[model samples]
Target: MTDRRPLVAGNWKMNGLSAAAAELDALAKALADRPAPACDVMIAPPFTLLAPFVAAASGTPIAIGGQDCSHLEPGAHTGDIAAVMLRDIGATSVIVGHSERRQDHHETDDLVRLKAEAAHEAGLVAIVCIGETEPERDRDQTLNVVTTQLAGSVPDAATADNTIIAYEPVWAIGTGRTPTAADVATVHGTIREVLVERFGEDIGNGLRILYGGSVKPANAGELMAVANVDGALVGGASLKAADFDGIIDAYR
Candidate 1:
């Protein structure tokens, strides 16, 4: 939270349609009169709306991203979009291996690794997600599961420039549940340790680690204040310009 630049990214998830474009424009216009906050902002809308959303966010501090990308650059992966394609469409980043994708699509860490590699290859920042389910948390195996996922999911080529880690408890995401500030600090600290050990001190400390799961403006400042909590990966609240803007203000 000190030297590390906070990044408040919105994961629009599967929501947002053409009309959602208005939210983007609204956000751009609303923030135009003010000085830029001491943080970064990004939004990952549904694939169908990336172009329009990016267009709407044009000239703003906001960066555009995709929810997911294919492991392969391009080929016969029907129904899948490649990282290159997303970049070609003006997306500067893409999320890979979110917990929902890991659960619904049975995406393995190896799969996530490949996808992250593809993102890096295409010059996109990969927000690689890692989290434990409710049962794992109940069993108090959160650190074990998180470390394992990080070890297996992050690409060897990953660096501060190309990768960001998000720690979202499965039980918390969209459930209005969240780990306490102390707990959040512990996990993020652990994740930071692993990152430094794997990627070296400079890159690891420089890499941003975001907290996700039911993040809202009301609780954002406290969460962002926690050690090692660089920012947030907002969910439902991100779909609304007002809510997302409020969350971004947490860094101020």
Candidate 2:
């Protein structure tokens, strides 16, 4: 059994507004009386509502994270928030190398590594995402693609404290499709091997490997039960309090 604590993280994407207030309220209430999990719980909301959410989450066990951040710390970069700035705003972590950023903005693994380094430098945990498209999987190159991404995107200084690896199959992001249990185990095990080879057993074994791609309350329990899957990087299902709370309950 893995000693790493499970982490259930909700990615709100570009959605949420004042209407999100109600959702957060529901989340707070749902978890209020419930015992906190042995693992971590976090939510990534749009920058606009981060402060509000952070304030609301204060005194609770929930953590606030950013969906993305600029590689540069602070500068003339337009429409970009830096890792340091995120920490200053009370964000405990940031998601880097998401498939959306890769597809929409054409971000490369090198850029992701730099961003992760920035997050680590600024004292925030960086959730570095890696995944393969459907074509890659069809061609049986899923492992190859993910290995390259894990090597290129993650920084050399990655430690259990400052880094997390999120394996999000690009094909499954919002397609309502998920890989089979065997498939998830294969990929997560492979990732763990890669981490161990590069970072040594102690650091590698301590690092949390999170599974993403169409994760929901329905499948959370089985997925979390799998080997090496220490957490989840939830997408659509995380928007609602009930759904996310259900996902969290899977760890129990």
In terms of TM-score, how similar is model 2 to the real structure? 0.98
Displacement of the residue 74 alpha carbon in candidate 2, Å: 0.9
**Candidate 1 overall lDDT versus native:** 0.91
Question: Which digits, one per residue and each the tens of the lDDT, describe model 1 over residues 90-180?
Answer: 9999998899999999999999999999999999999999999999999999999999999999998888789999999999999998999
Q: Which candidate wins on TM-score?
A: 2
Query: Which 10 consecutive residues of model 2 have the lowest summed lDDT?
Result: 30-39
How big is the positional error of residue 21 in model 1, measured in Å on the Cα after superposition? 0.9
User: Where does candidate 2 stray beyond 4 Å?
Assistant: none
**Superposition-based RMSD of candidate 2 using all C-alpha atoms, in angstroms:** 0.9
Task: Give per-model TM-scores.
Answer: 0.98, 0.98
Query: Which residue pairs does candidate 2 place in steric collision?
Result: none
